[model samples]
Target: MELYNWMVEPFQTGFQIRALLGGLLAAVMSSFVGVWLVLRGMSFFGDAFVHGVVPGIAAAVLFEFSPFLGAALAALVMVSLLELIHRTTSLKEDSAIGLLFVGMMALGVVLISRSDSFQGSLTAILFGDALGVSWADVQMQLLFVIGVGLMSLMLYRPLMSLSFSPDKSQALGMRPQLTHWLLLLMIAAAVIGSFQAVGTLLVLGLLIGPAAAAALITRTVPRMILTSLILGMISVTVGLIFSYHLGTAAGASMALVAILGFFLILTIRETVAAIVRRKRSTTLVEQGAS
Candidate 1:
């Protein structure tokens, strides 16, 4: 009973309940987005999107506006620029990402430095404040999940085709170009939806870690997404509980746990593969000797 109370006591509070809900919602939404990011090899694009939103959030803080709105706008602008540069210029994808990432992050720093009002919330913007999440924030995250989920379902076929073979998708009349833009929109929504829970800086861990872990264990896309969601939820729940008991930063704890899950899965998978390979090699040598 003492142990149960120790584990359950923090969630009894209103703020902690809100934090749990917010984190869970963010986790589910991010896992779905992370699956696509991992499949499409767009992890760098996700990272760029995460940093691109920083300037918008900084501006929002300075003006006392909605951070989500600012983040969405910034993400849209960055994605558009990336698309334009990649399509129109001779620069490669990596160059475009590097150029935009540094520029946006530097702009955010400049904007924040110029503002005195943003000092109080600067840490929260960079590192997140899960405990500070409010009911309104949870509501917004719910809307984001619903909207993004519906869009993903509608565009599932085209997105899948684009992920595996853009040329083939184009041949199938799926218009890979349009699907690509829609994917960018979905990524932007996911990043903004999760930003308040995990912050822009550590958001990549939440976005990529669980999906990477799930991919190693699951064979199909749906299974991978489901597994990723489970991993993400567990990470948030355990991280929050540990943070409450240990008096640590909740957001950082969650991000760390998610990353730890990826590494744990990787280690287990590699070990199993090594054992299987050794067995096969032994069998082959015995047959040759026979």
Candidate 2:
């Protein structure tokens, strides 16, 4: 009907199909990684990575290379720098993260202003408009998502162990150091994959919102991850539809809606629990009176 036509019309050409697929893939990949980021108390790091990638992404754009790879490498460099600073000095993780992120982001802005395609390149990289996606974009997202997914799946043991307790994991011969870097690499990959759909700015919604919401509603890591994926997809689909119809920013709308959905779920759960508690109290009162 009308809705079907709207959806199909945009995708009648291959370009739109790629855009759609890229977005969907980003949702899946980001949601999974977001869970870990939320659980590890490293939410800010993801945001930092988003900001920190500006210079690398800008450089890659100028060199006509893969901007996503450039962005990932840049983030890894920042992580390494943070680790070095933390180890070499008394600086806390938060302090280190703040210093590196701000410095790199400022440098990026300066470099970006010099590049002719800076605005356009950054717009696409930071907030995938979905309107500008090509087949190549879709292919890149697919490959990254699949590669990262398989990698994470295989390393689940070490990652989970490390997340629980690096000391314990290391004591148990798990190579916590190796696992730590691998987890960061996974996060970098997640952020890179989401660069086109959610953009670097809003992609954290995938890396944080879904996971936080899932955590609020679940007790186990696996359950949280599954819930995060579902919530992330819901955010993506709803945001896309609203953006398409209302002429709003798709990535922003999606992030807002996803966050709203988290609160909505919380409200509903609270209300239901309250009602159940009231009923239980009333039943107890009646029984005691009898």
* Candidate number with greatest TM-score: 1
The whole-model lDDT of each prediction reads 0.88, 0.80
Q: List the residue pairs that clash in candidate 2.
A: 34-207, 126-199
Per-residue CA lDDT of model 1 for 1-290, tens digit only, reads 99888878879989999988988888888887888899999999888889999999998988879998899888878987988998899999989999999999988888888787566567888888899898999999999999888887888789889988999999999999999888888888888888788888877887899998999999988898889989999999888999999998888999899999999999999999999999999999999999
TM-score of each: 0.94, 0.91
As a TM-score, model 1 comes out at 0.94
User: Which tens-of-lDDT digit does each residue in 139-237 have in candidate 2?
Assistant: 788888888778768877777888889898888888989877877888888888777777888888767877888888898888988898889888877
TM for candidate 2 is: 0.91
Off by over 4 Å in 2: 1-13
